[model samples]
Target: MEAAVKRRVEDYSLMDHATQSDPFEFYAALHEQCPVYRMPETGFYMVTRYDDLRQVLKDTDTFSNDVSAKDGKGLQGDLGVLYEEIIAERGWAHVQTLQRTDPPEHSRYRKLLDRVFTARRVREMLPYVDQVANDLIESWIDDGRCEFNSQFAMPMPGIIIAEQLGLGRKDVARFKRWADALIALSIRKWSEPEIRQIAETELEMQHYLFDVFEDRRKNPTGDLISALVHAHGDDEEPLSMHELQNLMHQLISGGFETTQSAIAHGLWLLLRHPETMQRLRGDMSLIKPFCEEAMRIESPVQGLARKTTRDVELNGTLIPAGSLVLTRYGAANRDPEKFECPHLFDIDRKNAGAQIAFGAGAHFCVGASLARQEMVSSFTALLTRLDDIRLEHDLPQPVHNPSLYFMPMKELPITFKKR
Candidate 1:
């Protein structure tokens, strides 16, 4: 309603450029001048400043997770994206990895999925994860010339998570399709037909998963799906079919994309700085920190869109109720005020351990532990076996998807020497 807010909206709503070029630059501009900007497209406000973002995320009472916000639905700040749209087409079980739910609902879904990522679960899986990574590495070890991204980084986590979920070898092909569909960034802006295509893919995937869930219900295999079938609230309400569907969708999206992107980006980062790689290979102890450091820099998830419950003030910026607010995690991660030499990747940074790649607040990613485990196993297997792992091609530029989430590399071609 204010001229300043209207003017600010015009700049931020140029989704044309934001979806194409480097959005971090745009976010930096927002952080510098208007850290909180209202968007006309979705009628939401976004905040990117370090202090503002931290405050907003932590203020769960004011900023609810169910950005499918109703009363203030048309307000100036809205946040939820990639929810039912992602689930209906892909099936609820697609990713069930967790995002965008308010406390009671999010807590219920998380309880079922969260157990898969426990310390004990992850530690136990490390050997198997390592074996998965090593087996892939060993196959390439003799080949001597391999495109690490496609050959190694992209596929290992898919196989490992699918197996750990007890989906087994039979489900490998469908699992990869789910992973590929989630990560294969559209080179062009997704048009109506493209949206239809995504819808269709979601439907087909949903049907496949529905079948799987049905089979699990009848047979009761005691796997995650079986556990889900049996999981309940204290009130003893069985998980609704819709909730189960959403749960499955989150699992597929999270399990597939995040790990693959982290591994790809981590390897790309290590490859870009051979000196860092050399130093890391020499001192493998540093690899864990290096992985976290790389994630801090090249964050797997880009930004989160949140809708404000009502008119609110953040960092002196007024966000009218019911607007889309993008919490630019990628930009926040690189904020120099938050991290020293934020642009430059440094594994040894003291605060590198504090990045929000898993996000902050009540809705933080449940799969953070799993992703960390996958990356640890993924890198350890590769770094330990490979003699000199380095890039084979020019550093690939980031392929930004039009969607508000995901910072996945289109392809990362690398050539490495084996021991």
Candidate 2:
């Protein structure tokens, strides 16, 4: 009789696409035996089941978002030696932004920013969004083909979010660059030069934001920055420069990276599933749900790290206190227990909204409404302005950064007939 080979958790590569084509399949196998599997490479526990993820996200006391604990070492601890200098020199230990902080402090910063993404504010962005999407399509509608990532997908959210944040349209490229660097840091391995590049970019982004905030202070505009600069929560003082910087970074990256990836991925999904594309083309109103379904299938932001405040037991496994736990939003969104035929990209999915693409609980993405708006508006323009839109390449390849945190299509070449 042949001996069975034990499936050691370390044997799987979380970041390498070469090892696995479908991450959901890889995770599904892992979830079958060990849903809360601890990674040997980084020692971060990954929770793949939908119920467990919801439990961890909701139980703020046991699972802490503010792993930094008043010291920005959370990133350093989760990322190891790569972030040693970043933690010390950059004062990373002190950062407890809305997404990273828990409770009382989190609510304070969240409330101040919440006003900016209110439904009315998002509604106001519709016309500008229509203009941006149409302008991009107009530039390439005649060419019959375009690299959708850089030309259309990347810039739609980039321009809209920049304008909303009181930044110049010319700075959209810069915003995308900074956001890319931030996501790159989540990777386990990088060359010295890459690390230096990230550190330098962080400093530049900080200085650039400093000047912008100074201008906003002196001459306020009806933008998110102005609202952040002037507003004070109930019995709370206005945000300090450091707090504002961290918050601003979160807003820009969250709004830019997540939405851009969704737009690109959504287009690719529609191209791959021509039936869904034809259905959407006919109805037109399905664009909204199509965006949600795309997000559910290929979540832009995959997973995030949280530190345990105390010893916790999940699914027969006991995790020690202070250990880092990674909740797999990508895996959870596709768990069979949560969604029927989870692997299929069903645009008419009745419960597509249940997906945690925007996360859940207190740290849920504040820009969810804005992201949804961008995706719906951009796709609507494409469907209206383009005819017989299809992928230029028979097997359109999706290039993802070798990081588990994000999955964005690197390039999408598609040919379309102008209407």
Q: Which is the leading candidate under lDDT?
A: 2
Which number leads on TM-score?
2
- Assess each prediction's global lDDT (C-alpha) against the native: 0.67, 0.79
lDDT tens digits by residue: candidate 2, 217-244: 8999988888888887568787888888
Candidate 1 regions exceeding 4 Å error are 1-21, 39-44, 68-98, 169-173, 179-189, 233-235, 395-403
Off by over 4 Å in 2: 1-11, 19-21, 68-94, 233-235, 394-398
TM-score of each: 0.84, 0.92
Return the lDDT, model 1, position 27.
60
TM for candidate 1 is: 0.84
Model 2 poorest 10 in a row by lDDT: 1-10
